[model samples]
Target: MTTPVSLTIPTPAEAARWAPEQIVALAQANAAAARQLDALQLEFQAMKHQIEWFRRQLFGAKSEKRIVDASPHQMNLGELPVPESSPPPPAKDIAAHTRRARTTDYAAGDASALFFDEARVPVETIAVANPEIDGLTADQFEVIGEKVSHRLAQRPGSYVILKYVRPVIKRLDTQAISCPAAPEGVIRGSRADVSFVAGLITDKFCYHQPLYRQHQRLGDNGIKVSRPWLTQLTHGALSLLEPIFTAQLDSIRASRIKAMDETPIKAGRAGPGKMKGGYFWPVYGERDEICFAYHEGRSGKHIAQTLGTDPPPEGAVLLTDGYAAYERYAEKCGLTHAQCWAHSRRKFFDAQALEPERAGQALEMIGKLYAVEKHIREARLVGEARRAHRLAQAKPVLQQFFAWVDAQFESQGLLPSSPLTTAMAYVRERRAALEVYLSDPEVPIDTNHLERALRVVPMGRRNWLFCWTEVGAKYVGIAQSLIATCRLHDIDPYTYLVDVLQRIGQYPAANVAQLTPRLWKQHFAANPLRSDLFEISK
Candidate 1:
């Protein structure tokens, strides 16, 4: 009852019925239709990939960790691939051994190092008077070790003000007043004490508490302070630490191998009530130090500015993600550039949904590279020895992986611009860069450490939002650089800031490197300067 929708195709006989001109036109039309169909299919697949990406962003697991099981319900598109494994090594049985409790003898004589560990907390003592002791004389009842009990206690409003009340005295002969001058503070003629400044910067940068929120907290605590005053205090505290940050930054740049990456921050004003974007180029040094250098633009020139325009020292290497700027910089500067393996693996990860079998094969190969890195860490290999092991174990795996990728290209089964082909092309192009880590022991197989250090930037942006100005963003970098480095060195950021803030004003400019957290840990951490209130409590 309905009209039939039949697809028509032109055959040789149908063309034969037409004139010569008509036949040529029909053949051109048919070829054009084939090309159009291919384009449409490519577009369709791209849209599907984008839709799946958005869905993952909204609902899927954020971790890129390889999954042990595949095709779990509700997780089809972006599920990570776990590599196929060979048979496990045979287990060897061991004789059972007795385990000891962690607590044991420690701190004998003048030594504090102990086999048994204890929490590092302040001790508060109180004398409990016994009624029996009140009735007995000192000689009548011998004093033995008293029973000890412990309970953890905490109090709110823990803030304390350091009051340095100076005694006023007058000379009888000259009528001159004399008192000890106030100790060096973080800022000149500023009411904000070093402890207060340290806490403000630490809370804002390290803890992501914005100035407005901090102002509210102070108001709630009965210490009324202006928001502008807090901002000024932060600026002053950061300015004091700039020299040390520079020294550490130089140390990072001078390392034999280091990581570099860029992250965006909304800094400066675009128009009324709007912000412009800037980037933080964070460099992670081999010594575990980091620096967040702020820039108005992300370009290869900035990388040169950080690493230098000159040819680097021999054997110097730069580790980075697959960013073009780093590639250009390293090439222009005549430096050895190594790419992250994890990034190459990520491309295949995204394509797994479309080309499950092919992408799975690629992911499994890359996963073996990670497995080698894990074993390297487990063995605690370093220097030449680590390099040797990687050459012996990791090099062969890499060779085989590249061979597979090359075979994929020669087969020519993957469509041009398709996800599978694109991933394979990315790996094939960077084969040399990917293999650089295998040759150098110091260069990490990935930039995960650098990413971890720079995480504070993005996490902070969520709470504190954007910087009011580009200068403000630079100040943010300075504070974060020091705090992040403090974390790497296992030093308490609050204590480090308090000591350095008080010491920096009087410290020699030529020897500012000693004020850096790495050097300060050795020079002054044993007996650091303290707030007057804390000293009195001691």
Candidate 2:
């Protein structure tokens, strides 16, 4: 069926009765509306271009180092010929002392040069007291002065206070789990504090220092432990905890909503420049628990294997940036892929950094989108409430915003070699993922939660440099995971590690959930300082 057009013009007879100017005015009005529509369309396109540029700079394939501005002093004046025949300036003449004015011009009558000499004398006094009396004796007074002089000895600098709280692990005489025996006289040792030993390996050896540094401290504190022995303990602890790590990975696979991100760690086994970097991929659940995986590579194949097969268990949504690997993994796993809008917005923002005018127009439009998100976030809406609110307030902005993107991308020479072109491409490619969050209450507006988590890698990187081996990198991943998890739970990492090392063996495996910072908070919430009861004896 053909639908009839909506608008109808007045009949010719009625049109003829109207003045000629009225007809012209009507035509002008229509032209003005068309012009306004065209302008709005251009503004939208510019916004999309700006947003896309930032996306590529951040999460897209276009990875290039941003050029830093040179300081004024750093600017070079082009090469110049050496100066020829420059002569040194002559010295200035000085007034002679004899010619200079003086106040003492009068001559005195000749008199013998007076000299006064007097005999010098020295006086000394001594204090005395009986040895058994309250008053000081001669010997006692000498002793007191000697002690005072010693105390008054000059020093170069004031002492500095070294504030460090020692770890508090009570010596519990306990039995360890029995395992198959090594050869005879192997000197089998039971590392009762396995978790702490893990921390020692991760925090000290793999990350900040070698095991010997820790061993030296132990020795200084009168604990006679060898570095080789500590290394053995670390290996043993990791071996014991491997199963728990595996179980945690299994738990992460069970989650419906997961956020995944990867960071590179230099694995020392790989040859210099030829070194293969390991990836710390954390797959976080919406619930209190998280699972971390350290993989040898950051390829799509690794991601697919880690996240599992296609047609992922029900309610699965994988959130990530515009990394193509993630897209492939999502496709292979049949998991719904959600791209970060922050990544999209960043594209434009980055372009704006280079091209201010185009970026300004783009930012104005994006600001509207953010304003709406900010409103919804401030309202603290979640689930259906959030989805409904976003659909109503934010959906139209997104539609208009994307439509603008489409028009810009279609135009020729509008993007070109400009980074804004890159930004535009990202929006067009991931438009569907960008919009999914508006429809689903569970989906976040962005993947910032996970990105923020990944920042720890860079922070710790600045301090400790790089991982020594694949095993060492894996240990770092484990420690960073626990420390980050503790931060998420609002627990002090040092205290948490110290407590775990001291009590983990006695802590029931079934109650491991309680050790998570969130749960630990509840147990100690009423009396947060309860852990302080176990302090190091001076």
Candidate 3:
């Protein structure tokens, strides 16, 4: 029913006569796809390597236990018996003993001659009244003049004792109502005397009473407060201070320049055989206004949301470690990134632990760069002065470092197992950011300020395990931010927390920003609105 199809075969000449335009277009398309695949493959490899390296660095390796089962032949160094030495002769009575019998004749015959010579001034004892001495003199006035008197001399390890000083409680008798349902013959303390009993809890037990173990102490004190109640109270106090915490965040956001970094925390109880990790990212802004945000996630989104939608001012910069997340966010926001040289140098330093001879040279070169920065920082150089100093002193060191790094790249293939190689790659990738501080006045040479702020997260993690919930995590962020900021300004955290908690609610919404740590410290320490709270300790 169907006609046989005509079978045809082209000759070599006909096949070679294909269109030149079509051949060129097809080749170009193939090349483009090959390039895309190659790029994707490279990215995937780099990311996989980085993740593997990070895992080793953070969790560390489970070291193999070397079992040396075979026992070696023992050679004993026998103990030599000590020969007993003869005892010395006994001392004779000085009053009845002859002068020649004594070994030291001067002590036997020269008792009267032992008096002071002309050079030895035994003259007189000078008595001075210490201004710091506590006591009253005549007329209820402190003594001011020196006089000779017998007094107990202070011995070694002695110090003036300071008694317990309690904060003065204020009572407000706005109104009163008599209660008719009072228990028979029962008496009660004033309600005004009640206060939030707050104390810092560390890994240590209170006089050897741990938190779970503290039940006995509470019961013995005739108080029936449960452990959970104490935990809730601590959280409640933190929640009450949240407004002041928000005020600090607002202030940090208002500044032109900001620095940020993160530290890890462990949540041992989050799941079975799994440790949940959280981050403490601290951001420091203008006037050294510091704030820490504890993030449960370590993605680039944290950076994006923390640093809002704008570039820091023209000369302003954000200092950070070589975290790619930071780099991505910084580029997106148009902020100049000032990379930390300490982090760069630290990588090489750790390399010394694994590969001493090879890492030594790289470390020496990195060390020179740090020496220059240390000189500038130690001179109290900041802003334009610091920038100028670093430029003059550090530029050459950095240039030398870069040249050496280039040499290493050409000569060395960094093994994934080597930490030095990882560090070198970090420095090599972040070369531009590392050099930014030399040119910009507002940029810092290190992210230490932010790092120092976030260290508490890890230190606290060793004790508290994980945050109980998201709300608990938020509470920690607020409390830690306020407490750490207070420390930054050299203000006592307890005093600052108390003052703010009592007055933050009363502060006008328009001026709530003034309650920020930096502002609050200045206001409360200098010209305080509440005179009773700010009185200097006597």
Query: Pick by lDDT: which candidate is best?
Result: 1
By TM-score, how accurate is candidate 2? 0.58
Give per-model TM-scores.
Answer: 0.80, 0.58, 0.60
Which 10 residues in a row give candidate 1 its minimum summed lDDT? 108-117
The Cα error of candidate 2 at residue 176, in Å, is 27
Q: What local distance difference test score does each model get?
A: 0.77, 0.59, 0.58
Model 3 spans with C-alpha error above 4 angstroms: 1-222, 266-276, 412-418, 526-538
**Residue-level lDDT for 208 in candidate 1:** 93
Using TM-score as the measure, the top candidate is 1
Question: Is 2 or 3 the stronger prediction by lDDT?
Answer: 2
For model 3, residues 111-205, the per-residue Cα lDDT tens digits are 22222221221112222223322253444332222222211111111111111122221112322222122111100221110022223221111
* Residue 42 alpha-carbon offset, candidate 1, angstroms: 0.4
Q: TM-score-based ranking, best first? A: 1, 3, 2
| Candidate 2 residue-wise lDDT at 301 | 77
**Candidate 1 local lDDT, residue 128:** 41
Off by over 4 Å in 2: 1-240, 272-274, 502-538
